[model samples]
Target: MWREPWPSSNRMPFTKKRKLQLSPEQCSDFYADQYGKFFFPSLTAFMSSGPIIALTLARNNAIAHWKSIIGPVNSTKARETHPECLRAKYGTSDLKNALHGSESFHAAEREIKFMFPNSVIEPFPSREGIEEYLSRYVNPTLLHGLTELCKHKPHNPCVWLADWLMKNSPNKPKICDGVTVEEAE
Candidate 1:
């Protein structure tokens, strides 16, 4: 009864037959546009696999946090361990990790564009909404990494540390004594 409705969904199985294939935009527009061909001809074929929920998580190190949250991309390894991870919990194979995130900000921008062209995918922290900032806040070091990423540069631990400080400084966040996989390790 726990895994209702979504069992055997395409998302549960990351197979060649189930992958979504989005095409690149073709060139030569103006009355009759003719250039690009469909990249994944069968993306439409798998429409009813399941309903996917899209989440926009706000954290100092959003991408990295998400990567960690989802854990590694492998599934068999996920099964034996990483049970707390999204992949470890539900991923049937190497592909279905139950979530997705932008590898980079540029990619995030492009992907947001592709998925929701007119939809507003705002940066963390609304300019005017004070309460929202608490929920959508980012720490300095994490922001720095995102800045470096925008410039196409590699990240440094110092930047990551800065983000860590930003995330924990204001709240003086509690350190859990409750057992967790990371804590057990």
Candidate 2:
């Protein structure tokens, strides 16, 4: 996203320019300072990086749950991390802090449009979700948790996961009912 003080049609000032110059990491720090550290480089960077906010979340509690995960506007003002709060880690500055979850369902629809003008926030879309999720979840380890899940039960786990997926996931199934790990391999 591009952070210009004035509208694309209007002339702007230098402060917005400075805000724009922040590297993704510095931006992350800035937002982390606000408690956006655990959310979507911390959302503070992304917000400060641009003038508007947008999201095309799924129908399943995407807005409300995202808000819960985002935590309060003030990280210090909040109580628990909500256990799954996005701000528990990523937030930093209030001005540049991460995430502005839609206040209501209607707002989510409107905000999503403003944040995403094109068809959707798909791959190679206007904003960046891949980098966002990474900054939120990555640790020092080389392997993500999935590596252990893969190693522990390549055979049994797939079925377990497939069932869970069938029960809870919106994404389609990849592994067939009769397919074996060897076949997959």
Which candidate ranks first by lDDT, i.e. highest? 1
Model 2, stretches more than 4 Å misplaced?
1-54, 79-84, 120-185
Model 1 pairs whose backbones collide: 141-163, 142-163
Question: Model 1 lDDT vs. the true structure?
Answer: 0.48
Tens digits of per-residue lDDT for model 2, 76-133: 5543534345554545555443445567765544444443445444334333676665
For every model shown, what is its TM-score relative to the native structure? 0.41, 0.35
Number of the top-ranking candidate, with TM-score as the measure: 1
Residue 18, model 2: Cα distance from true site in angstroms: 22
> What is the C-alpha lDDT profile of model 1 across 1-185, one tens digit per residue?
01113334323212111223232221111101222445222222222244444334455666787677667668678667677776777766554445555677766566555544465666665556755564455444356556655675436756755665655554454456763223220
For model 1 the TM-score comes to: 0.41
Instruction: Tell me the number of clashing residue pairs for each predicted model.
Output: 2, 23
In the order shown, the candidates' Cα RMSDs to the true structure are 19.2, 17.9
